[model samples]
Target: MIAILSDIHGNLPALEAVIADARTAGATAFVNLGDSLSGPLWPAETADLLMREGWPAIAGNHERQVLTHAIERMGASDRFASERLSAAQLAWLAAQPPVLALTDEIFLCHGSPRSDLEHLLHTVEAAGIRQATEAEIAERLGDTPAALTLCGHTHLPRTVTLADGRTIANPGSVGLQAFHDDHPLPYIVENGDPLARYALVRGTGVELRAVAYDHLGAAAKAAREGRADWAAALRTGLAG
Candidate 1:
């Protein structure tokens, strides 16, 4: 079995709980879909753990932004992570690819195959956020020939099988559960509860799993860091 993780966003406690749970579930290997260490929680510590484990990982949009953008111009989450990460940690993030092929039949990407900042399974519309059509997903997938494509950017857990037998899955977020985004429009993604999330890939199926952790402590830590919005989201899995 393979354990799939994504969008950790620097909450080490949550990651730990998810790892333990994955082990108990008989996951023999692990793959990370990035957006790993950009948040107000434990950026450096999270980096340490992930780096030591040396799991097959990719770089999400936030990782690229944190590395390329001026620190002053970064958002709170990226800026906070940038300030806390050591030089080696920054280098580690820089080393990851925007997308990867785990095997001849399995592909991994933070978002779309074409763009780390784009959502592979979802789209932003004037009406609201919604799942992308098969055509749209196929377009974003481009010429990648992997039968199983794994992506995570919207922080939503989903598994979709294309008409051609290609499967795409998002395991959800391991840390932050809810977030508001404003790009072409404004929309929010929420899991409706505070829990650490991940996925188990077994045989030809995907299982979304949520594990309990010390979320209140994570909320208090975010509060102490002066991000009440993060604190609220960590507590309730709802944006403030």
Candidate 2:
């Protein structure tokens, strides 16, 4: 079985908890879907841990933006995340691809195969997030023929089946659970708790899992790093 994770966003405690839980749940292999260190908790430390594990990962929109976008074009959070990384870590992150194929049956990408910034299965409505129609999602998927396509960017756990029976999974965020983003549109992502999220795929089935960790500890780390917003998000999984 393989544990697929995404949007870890530098919360080492949360990532550790999710990995431990996945191990206990019989996952032997791991794939990361990116946005691994774009938060205030511990970008370099998180990257080092993942590097030590040698898990293959793709680049999320955050990763692309942080690496390629000019500093003047970056948001406050992006600037904050970029400043905390070492030159070596930055180089490593810049090297990750936006899309990867693990096998004939599995393909991994941050947001979608077409664009790292587009949501494959979600539309940002005024009320909140709405699941895109099957055709809409399939259009976003384009010509990829992988049976299972994994993506993450919105930090929400999701699974969708296209009309052709292909499955798309958003394993969700492993670290930061709640936040506001303004890239493609203004939207908020919250899971109602500061729990690490990932997914395990075995045989032909997928199981989304949330692993609770030391939220206060992560919050403390964020506070120490001068990110009160992150501290608050860690304490309460809300954009407020």
Candidate 3:
């Protein structure tokens, strides 16, 4: 079995819990869909763990921002992680591909096939974010021939099977459960709980799973760092 994880965002305890749970579920191989260390909790330690694991991984848009943007211009989360990551860790992030074909039939990307910042299964408009229509997903997907495509960016666990029988799955965030984002527009994503999330791919099906961890401890650490917003999200899975 293969386990798919994404948007870890530096919460080490949550990642550990998800890893243990995946192993228990008979997952022998792991795929990491990135956004791994761009948070206030444990960027350096998370980097250490992920580096040791050496899972097949891809880079999210945050990875690009952290690597190329000047420190002064980076968002607070990216800046915190960038500051704490070592040169080796940064190198690892730099080396990750924005899109990866995991197998002849399994494709992996941080977001859509064309843009790391675009949501593969979602659309944003005047009303805010909503599930992407089949046409929109097809447009973003282009002509990728993979039977199964995996992406993670919005931190929402979802699976969509197109009318053509192609499947797209997002394993969701192992670290963060909810957050507000502003780019082309403003939006919020919330899973409504503090458990870490991932997906198990067995046969041709994907199972969305959540695992319990010491989320309060993580919240405390974020509070200590003066990230009350992160702390609130960590504690309640609701964006502050």
Per-model C-alpha RMSD:
1.0, 1.5, 0.8
TM-score per candidate, chains pooled: 0.97, 0.94, 0.98
Whose TM-score is greatest here?
3
List runs of model 2 lying over 4 Å from the truth.
none
Q: Which numbered prediction scores highest in lDDT against the true structure?
A: 3
Model 1 ranges with Cα > 4 A deviation: none
Error of 3 at 113 (Å): 0.4
> What lDDT score is found at residue 141 in candidate 1?
88
CA lDDT, candidate 3, residue 216:
100
**Separate clash counts for every candidate:** 0, 0, 0
Which pairs of residues collide in model 2? Answer: none
Candidate 3 structure quality by residue, lDDT tens digits, 138-175: 99999999999999998998899999989999988999
User: Which wins on TM-score, candidate 2 or candidate 3?
Assistant: 3
Query: What stretches of model 3 exceed 4 Å from their correct place?
Result: none
lDDT string, candidate 1, 1-240, tens digits? 999999999999999999999999899999999999998899999999999999999999999999999988999999999999999999999999999989888899998998887888999988778989999998998888988899998998988999989999999999999988997589888888899989998865889999999999999999999999899999999987
Query: Given candidate 2, what's the lDDT at residue 198?
Result: 97
Task: Write the number of the candidate with greater lDDT, choosing between 1 and 2.
Answer: 1
Instruction: Estimate the overall C-alpha local distance difference test score of candidate 1.
Output: 0.92
